[model samples]
Target: EGDSFRIDEPIYLYIEPIGYTIKENPKSSYEFGFFADFTIEGEDGKVLGGQKDFAKLDFKSWNFNTEITLTFTYTISFFSIQVFPQYPDLFSHQDNQ
Candidate 1:
């Protein structure tokens, strides 16, 4: 995966969580679920935006599966270089590009 992404481009993520809690379902199946939160930060450590519980996964299986994969997709549309009021020229340069 690259560190840089274009505006409004789709970003894909694959995650594997360890030591997550598993519960027994009423139907004699095992159940597991998780929620994820995310934040977008600039190089200067300023939090640009974020979402709580942006992705959620729940599963029920007959076997206690040790391997699980979670996939998440995100698109950044609201982010803008114009956020920096102190850098008017920077915004203009981006527009010219």
Candidate 2:
């Protein structure tokens, strides 16, 4: 799917973090962790909504693998639509009409 999404549809985002800091655990294993915050903005650049520390990824591995992928999923429902009714039209299929 493209970047544009319907109001009723869920948004799925995948991120790969490179050159992340890796530390050694007490048991001689490698440990790495990451967290993310997100914000939803309108076309006018106004921040409609967001959350801090929305997702956290932590891993302990025997090998120091640099490749990692983080997935984030979100759906806009009652709260966002209720607060920004006008915004939904921008993403809804009806907008094409």
Candidate 3:
């Protein structure tokens, strides 16, 4: 069976926000929540994963919840890499924040 992919093989994953609504909080960062359906599609247009009505975005800052949304444009991107057994930790413990 050659159906299994190799560990070092490269894959592409893309994320696009079809629609979203923003609410202004005004004191600090932007306090925004949205209801959207998303799908994880591979380079060949095959859907690997998806979610409906999912809203789980958290900010870990003192003024996180108090952030007011202002007139701004944002761009979000996603990337992935294959980690082999020979490689060291991609991220250090302290870098997790």
RMSD of 1: 7.2
Estimated TM-score per prediction? 0.76, 0.75, 0.26
List ranges where model 3 is wrong by over 4 Å: 1-33, 56-97
Best-fitting candidate, measured by TM-score?
Answer: 1
Report how far off residue 84 is in candidate 1 (Å): 6.0
Backbone clash pairs for candidate 2 read none
- Ten residues in sequence with the least summed lDDT for candidate 3: 88-97
What tens-digit string does per-residue lDDT give for candidate 3 at 20-89? 4444555544545545455544434555455676556533333434333322121223323433233322
Q: lDDT per residue, candidate 2, 1-97, as tens digits? A: 6555667678777778877899998889999999887776655556666778877878999997889988867776544545446654444211111
lDDT of 3: 0.37
lDDT of each: 0.69, 0.68, 0.37
Q: State candidate 2's TM-score.
A: 0.75
**lDDT tens string, model 1, 1-97?**
4555656667787888899988988888999999888877654556667778876778899998889988878777675667655642221111011
lDDT of 1 at 19: 92
Model 2 ranges with Cα > 4 A deviation: 79-87, 91-97
- lDDT order of candidates, top first: 1, 2, 3
